[model samples]
Target: MGASARMRLQLQPPAIMAEVERLLAGRTRDIRLKGELRRLFQERSWPRTAKIIRAWMTWVIMLDALTLGLNAVLLPRAIALSMILPACILPPAALASAFVWTKPRAFWLQRLSITGGMFFILMSVALVGVGAGGEFYERHLNIMLFVATTAIIIFAVPLRWTLTVAAMALGLYLFFQLHNPRLETGSAVAATLFFASGIIATVVARRTMNILAQKTFLLELRDRSRVAELADANARLERLARTDPLTGIANRRWMMETLHRLWSDGMKGRDAAMLMCDIDDFKSLNDRLGHAEGDRCLVKVAGIIQSSVRRNRDHVARYGGEEFLVVLPGADEREAAHIAERIRQGVEAASLPNPASRVAPYVTLSIGVAAQAPDDAIASPEQLQHRADAALYLAKQAGRNRVVLHRPDPPGS
Candidate 1:
């Protein structure tokens, strides 16, 4: 592998970051992240190894059959027959491995297939040389070593699997070489050592590559977890900015934003309305009780207004101290007045205690209503809000607990 790109800094879960740090710190031999890393590595590694093996198996069968045919046609018949017949074992073995790798199977089953199949392929290569009986015997042994070397380099399985394949390949090379009648003890040992050294080097390199891949996987998990955390944080901040903490309702900022959006030029022909509600004798209630009790009253009143309005079509917000604003879509002044009256009755019925009030024994609200019909030439959202504000001033001036609709002064009088 070329130089790895640097991983970026990101916040992740503590347990995952710990595991990633441990692996980066070169502690590769232990169970990772309480077995979570193990499962994740397998999920990523298994399919990659299977794909390489599946493609290789097809090529192996074809090449083995071609070698057998070519040997029969070009070489002497006795030598060819001996070599070709034993080598026939290779094609079917490769086919069997292909069948296993092409389909998904249990982990243990895949392990067995890889381990067992490598042995079969390597042994068949050695047996072909044995059947050839002369100079071909030693020559075929070299071919087997060469084949094993390639397998070790190409199959990026786990370190254990690589070690197992390396051990089996080296053992087979020595076992068959020692039995050769033409070779002396010294030569046999030398040849085995030479091939064994090459296989061992290849196994070490494969292990390094595997570790790098696992480290990359850990980095990916960190980035994904960080992205999730950032998204959740942003959502919460947005809510806090738009919502009143005391009443658990939308704040003035959100209400103004909604009104501007509804009355924007692009939203022409849409009908919208608002209700400006004030708690009558709210100052007296706060002075009589404490601020904590006032908070409770605000929450209760907010809930009442919320329940009275259409769920999604109307938005209720705490406009400021002792006041709430409601944005209603598609409601005329008459529909708005009806909604305001319902809110008035709901708050009066709640009986949240304001003996100091002049309106009644219980808490009361005075609401002002204004609406924009589809045909009306409302200049801006602020103008509509001003109309509602004017209506609220009128209601307060006339009497405390009542709903008053803002009727435009007759034709600019």
Candidate 2:
């Protein structure tokens, strides 16, 4: 034998045995959890199951009509007449059941129609067999009925209804056999055995299919849960990417994107403003007190800036170390300057002690304000940002704790 065949011969038995054990364990757990099976099947597989039932109903109706037609030719007049009404009524009833398949509340009507049709077929066969020749006819008819029961069970109806229909048909068949004198003891025993075997097989087949269906539903649910978790994780990662860890505000990258968006809006006839803010004597604070104290001061200053810009359209970002930027849409130079002044005052009012500071006894800010209207030809967002930076330099040059606005050069300056 080849290497693969040899390996298979050595390995296949253990693998098959292991799989068999696993399946047995799974079957036991499924039986224990059978109460939940109906609910899960309804939630995930009801529509498909309904369609299968409808299709099977159509096929069963066709097959029943064909069998009845053949039997009508061979059976006596009374049996043929009895078969005629059911053959005429059942196909139409099955068609009507198809119409309600989409309506879940009306599902029982389909089940009843299908089970009722099967029961009628069983009764018709029994009736025809009783009125026909002898033991030969009864034996053949019972076999046919067993085949019909097996067909119905193969449609995989829910277990409760399956059991109900099986019980009714089997009980009716036994009653007929007991009443009929021509059915010999041997024939009766054989018929009963066949009927019992078919029912057991039906139950086993339905249970196996149910187990498979439940496993598929569980896998789908797990996949959906994993997808939702992945989506949530992606959202959190995106938020972290754009947010400053220290200040709990927009970071430099987000601020740059906001500047670009505002600049685009500015080109479309809207006004936007930017304010650059620097903590006065931040290096000195970090030097005298520890960097930990400097971090606390930055957090306090960030809160002040965020609170000072009360408009919902405005955003604040930590541009870099000890510096923050604000974007205000639809704001003019005056509004931007006013907002910057409030931020400077708010920081000073907080009275964060800065011993090494020259600006004030407490920490303060130097802010630069720049505004652009739609008509202005500021070629890019960088130009507006540069103007804000220059104004901030001017603010620090003149005084460490004040606001300064950028001005374009006059026509003849």
Q: Name the candidate that leads on TM-score.
A: 1
1-413 in candidate 1: lDDT tens per residue?
11122122344348767777766677664424337666656665666787888777777777788888898898899999888667877777777877887766877777777788888888888899898878888888888788777777788776777788788888887888889999888988998898878888888788777766777777676665678678889999999999999988999999888877776747542577888999999999888887888889999999999999998889899998999988787888789899999999999999999887888878999999888855668546677777888889899998879999988787758
Worst 10 residues of 1 by lDDT: 1-10
Candidate 2 C-alpha lDDT tens digits along 1-413? 34553233233234433443344456544532233333444645666767876786677578768877787788776756755653565566557655556557555675776567566656655555555546534663565466456645566566767776676677777777766687676777678777778777877777777667655554444444456568789999989999999989999999887767766755432577889999999999999999999999999999999999965779899998999998877788888889899999999899998999997878999999888855677436677778899999999999789999998777899
lDDT of 2 at 367: 94
State, as a TM-score between 0 and 1, how close model 1 is to the true structure: 0.84
Using all chains and alpha carbons, the TM-scores for the candidates as numbered come to 0.84, 0.74
How far off is residue 176 in model 2, in Å? 3.0
**Model 2 CA lDDT for position 338:** 90
Clashing pairs in 2: none
